[model samples]
Target: MSDADLPFTAALYASTRTEELAPLPWPEEAKRMFLAQQHAAQHAHYQQHYRGMEAWIVEHGGAAIGRLYLHDMPGEIRIVDISLIPEARGQGIGAALLHDLFAQARLRERRVTIHVEKNNPARTLYARLGFTILDDDRGAYDLWEWRAAA
Candidate 1:
């Protein structure tokens, strides 16, 4: 994503983060502030840990709806993150994107991996897409992997 996309991307991140934080009973305004801070920190963490990441802005009907960050290394294509706005979610957009990624990985003969929170609803989708747990011992996030049949 370009610098011009930062605000929109961050807003998308905040929306997804808001859903994850919904169970916490925090005041709306306070949650807003917390989400902003958390977004900045998470962005920084991604920058530091995954250099050369590719950030893509997900769009549909000529409007921005989400962000997908990938760390494409030699043997694996890691889904650094992927999220869609609440309204845009559960509409098969995410599954379509994953199918595209899987096709690309299949051609490249590379595996795909992602770390997702245990309770994230998207984990069900990932499982349905044939992503198996690689490491569930992770505190909150379990590492999942998928590869084409040999």
Candidate 2:
């Protein structure tokens, strides 16, 4: 569907297949590809688990500005990662993106869960959205979850 069809004021979400993100527009950390390649065997591992994947792209005024990745599960949808370009940070764009995400999840009666890097500022934003830290390991990071308070 076209961005114009999205009811959200700022962003549109398009759910798609995992293979579709093979050549993503996202920036990768240095050596990230090499590391992923080194564990190529694990590629199949992930692909098998998340057989269905969807990439969320945030656009504004016809310009692509952000992205997020997710996969549907038997009882939930997992938000793997999300990022917005530096220029768009702190513009209420992320919250709007997440608000739409939660609305979609709640409509389906599924909880929203995500992993947050300890140093990432988005954790603060997620907290404001009612996500609570579920687990933490100093070096690895933490898990946060938000359930509809029924």
Candidate 3:
């Protein structure tokens, strides 16, 4: 995403963050403050750590719905992050994006990898899409990988 896209992309990020915070018992204002701070920190972390990260603002029918961050290297395409607003959830968007990523991986002959929290519902989708756990030693998150059949 470009500098100009930051404002809208951040809004998209905030929507996803709101969903994440939904289960907490905190007040609305507290959630708002926490999300704002967390977004800034996460953005900075991505910028500083992944110099060549490819960030995309996922859009549907002219409206921004989510964000995708990827890090492409020699033999792997790492999905640093992918998040959608609550309204966009369960709408097949994430699966479509994964299929597109898989196509890219097939063309490039590289494996696709992503880290998903162990209890995250999306882990089921990843598994259904043929991503197998590569590592689960990192506590909450498991590293998953998918490669085309030879």
Candidate 4:
């Protein structure tokens, strides 16, 4: 993603965390500021971990909608992060993108892996997409992997 995409990216990040922060007693501005800082830290962490990762902006109707960060490692394609605006979710966009990734992995004979938060709703979708848990990080996050059917 380019510098021009920062605002949209931050908005998407905030959307993902809105529900978790909603019940908190913080003011809206404070919550937004915290999310901005968290988003910056997350961006830095991804850059550090996936040095040569591929970045793609998910678009719909010619407008930017989300971001998909991927790393094509030696034996696996790691989905570093995937975020969609709240309005664009639940419409099968994410599933379709993931299915495309799965197809690509199959062609290359590589596993597709992702880590999802323990309580993230997307974990159910990943499981439905045939990803099996490879590691459970003590209830924080689960590492999931999907391999091409033999």
Candidate 5:
């Protein structure tokens, strides 16, 4: 993602967390402010930990729709994060993207991994795509991995 995509990327981040934030009783402006701060922090953390990671802007109909962050390591391709705007979700865009990533991973014989919230709905899709829980700390997130069969 480029500097031009920052606003849309922030909005996509907020959309992903909207359901969790809905019951917080914060005013809309306050929520937006918090989301912006959180997005900045997360972005910084990812950049610090996964320097040179690949970032992609998911587009549909010539408009930006989402963001995909990836880190390709020697043995695994880590999905740092993926978020879509509310209007663009549940339309198979995410699945298609994952399938494409899986194809690439298969070609390189590398495992694909992601850390997802325990209750995130996308976990179901990852399961359907053959990802298995590689580590679960019983915390907010679990590490999942997928490998193409021999």
Candidate 6:
């Protein structure tokens, strides 16, 4: 396959132990821990529902550095989860990945939405991209969404 296809060739697997996710092709530095946790803790959701959820891989220099897990419904696309290793942050990987995903949503005419931990720095990134605050849970996260131009 061509290089462009290579990046899209990233693979995803479910976690059997509900623990750390299987490693991606990127370096450990690129996948830094978040919130004082291993930061690789979401693999369980992917593994358990592998058949139902769709995984999109994000790559840089032909190496997989992150992932975007989505839940697509009739009229909306929920960005159920996204992550970039610490090493990959500040290098524009997140923005690029998000842009591609949202663009896909726009093309399908689906409203795009996601949940973010209040303290995550990516919150600013989403805001800059025009996603607005919709609702929130007092505990830790807020719901955000972006709609197509009317």
lDDT of 6 by residue, 88-119 (tens): 76788778877887789889999888888787
Quality of model 6 by C-alpha lDDT = 0.66
Q: For each candidate, C-alpha RMSD in Å?
A: 1.3, 9.2, 1.7, 1.0, 1.0, 8.3
Instruction: State the displacement of the C-alpha of residue 139, model 2, in Å, after optimal TM-score superposition.
Output: 4.1
lDDT of each: 0.91, 0.66, 0.88, 0.92, 0.92, 0.66
Candidate 1 lDDT by residue in tens digits, 1-150: 887987886788788776578899899889888878888889899999999999899999989988899999999999999999889999999999999999999999999999999889899999999999999999999999999988
lDDT of 2 by residue, 1-150 (tens): 234423321221222112234477655543344344433443345457666667556678997776666877766778865766666879999898888889999899998888777866678888999999888864667988888889
Candidate closest to the true structure, highest lDDT: 4
lDDT of 5 at 132: 99
Higher-lDDT candidate among 3 and 4?
Answer: 4
User: Over the full model, what C-alpha lDDT does candidate 1 score relative to the true structure?
Assistant: 0.91
Worst 10 residues of 6 by lDDT: 9-18
Provide the TM-score for each candidate, comma-separated.
Answer: 0.94, 0.67, 0.90, 0.97, 0.96, 0.67
Count of clashing pairs, candidate 5: 0
Candidate 4, residues 10-91, lDDT tens digits: the string is 8899999998999999999999999999999988998898999998999999999999999999999999999788888989
Q: Report the alpha-carbon TM-score of model 1 versus the true structure.
A: 0.94
Candidate 3 lDDT over 65-90, as tens digits, reads 88899999879999999988788999
lDDT string, candidate 5, 67-106, tens digits: 9999989999999998888888889999999999999998
Which 10-residue window of candidate 4 scores lowest in summed lDDT?
Answer: 135-144
